[model samples]
Target: MSETTWPWGAGTATGIGSLPGTDVAEAQRIVLGELPDLPHLPELPDRGPGADLIGRTGGLLVELPVELYAARWRIAPRPGKDLRRARDLMERDLDQLAEQAEEYAGPVKVQAAGPFTLAASLELPIGGRLLRDPGAVRDLAGSLGEGLRGHVAAVDRRLPHATVLLQLDEPSLPAVLAGRVPTESGFGTHRAVESEVARALLHGVIEAAGVPTVVHCCAADVPLELIRTAGAVGVALDLALVTDLDPLGEAIDAGLGLLAGAAPALPPPAGRAPTSAQVADRVRRVWDQLGFSRRRLAEQVVVTPACGLAGADPAYVRAVLAACRDAGRRLAEE
Candidate 1:
């Protein structure tokens, strides 16, 4: 593990990027209020097309431009309406943050689709998914790196006192590694990307991001070793979905921080929501199972929801964020 200062400091609790609703102002206010320790710039996918992950991230590329075609994001020769719409949405969100976070001084986060996930999702200029061509994938990663550099710069320009953390969302990584991504025609699967190449590209992006980087993959089989190899200081994953502990134990022992998604993002079936004790209990169980000391939990682990709360209703989102904040406090007390 890298022995650098963590941007979130201790007892940090945060959300996984996207929040529910289209009102950027309300989302920013709630996130900043609830997750004061490690608030993230909210992503409102409900804004439709360009606000979704692929199209949203595609807007950040330095020279690369993409357009929505045939229900997929495809490379375009020049910036088009779709690209402009995405950038406009992002800029407006940044403005909302700047307005809402006045005089605030704490760690803030911004997320972008990581390289492999982007490659797996984006279509090449020639029609195939970018993952099909290794050279094209490399080029895309480089472009994304540059794009992310600009993204971080933009966030810094807004939240000047905020120690910004970069979260690289890689939900499709496991599918990419397993060669399960659909081919152009949607009938076949692409060949699995080599782990070495994948790790190297991730490393490049982490370096380019120029902030304390965290790799978030809410997949059951999170590649902890690969994430560590890629120079990510933290590994963010859904603790409940994880069945094995050997690799996680090893990573924690190696000093890699865990952005443990211990709380549920979705709403409850009954009247009351999950208590902070319940959330802390889940994390405590995992720590005990890993044979880790309880005292180090607060500093080494950050409490968060299982994943993005984009699909949840506004009320549920607020409750979940508040629960996460309480969970972090409970973990510290534990």
Candidate 2:
């Protein structure tokens, strides 16, 4: 997508959703302060149960209620305590976001588990994984799509001046495509899904959201082409995990914005942090290696940590976010 059509501006920086603490207000403050150009709603998995990625996203489903059963999220017959708790936690987070960003304008992101990742994580009512039943997976995708439409609308209502961007996290997509997802009995694996099916489902959700969408897959061998075909305006992944640069270069050349995870999400050795120039150089090197123009880096790339900071030290979290923000500015200045 062109810079004019995209939600984020040149040299913008953003996080990959989750943070380490349970203080929603504090997290929102930090995100807004650090990433003024493209702040995201902070997800605090530290809150337990319904606050985690799957549970929180599952709570948003239109009709398919989910509950924590046997230590995993499972489709429930109806709305229950677990589902209610998850939705409540999300509502509280949104309230905090509204309060903190009352006057903030620009692109703000809201995230969720993508259709394939949810399929791999959520269990069926009858005991097997939702991935095992194709029909049920389709139904789940539809529900998620409709749910995301409502979610985008809700965010827009709360932050009236901000343009909402949807991010779909698909950490399990590589496993799903490789047929590595374990069966319910743990004795076998589910069948691999075709790329076309995955693309179609993802496209459905993106279209339903009615906003610019980015697909984040931090794992190795990220399906860059598939994500681009699935209609994501951008692809977010760890730059370190990318062993093959040709696909990345191709994707960028095709006008796909890159959320480059060039900074380390984990704490640096001896508690020392890298400078902004050092962080920005990572993307510059990649651009040079790909033979792309330096000018395009500012327009097509966003600096971020390699992944979520949910497990990083709190001090390191702040440092990393600052590094990302400064790095973006460095890229822009170049």
The prediction achieving the highest lDDT against the true structure is 2
Residues 1-334 of candidate 1 have per-residue lDDT tens digits of 2344566766678999998788889899899889989999889898998899999999998788999998799889999999999999999988888898856798888988999899998988788989999998988999999999999988888888787889999999999988899997889999998888889999998898888899999899888899998899899999888988999999988878899998777776774557877888888889989887776787888889999999888888888788888888887876
- As a TM-score, model 1 comes out at 0.96
RMSD vs true structure, all candidates: 1.5, 1.1
lDDT: worst 10-residue window of model 2:
1-10
Candidate 2 ranges with C-alpha deviation above 4 Å:
1-4
What does candidate 2's lDDT look like per residue over 51-148, in tens digits? 99999999999899999998899999999999999999999999999999978889999999999999999999988889999999999999999999
TM-score of 2: 0.98
TM-score of each: 0.96, 0.98
lDDT (0 to 1) per candidate: 0.87, 0.91
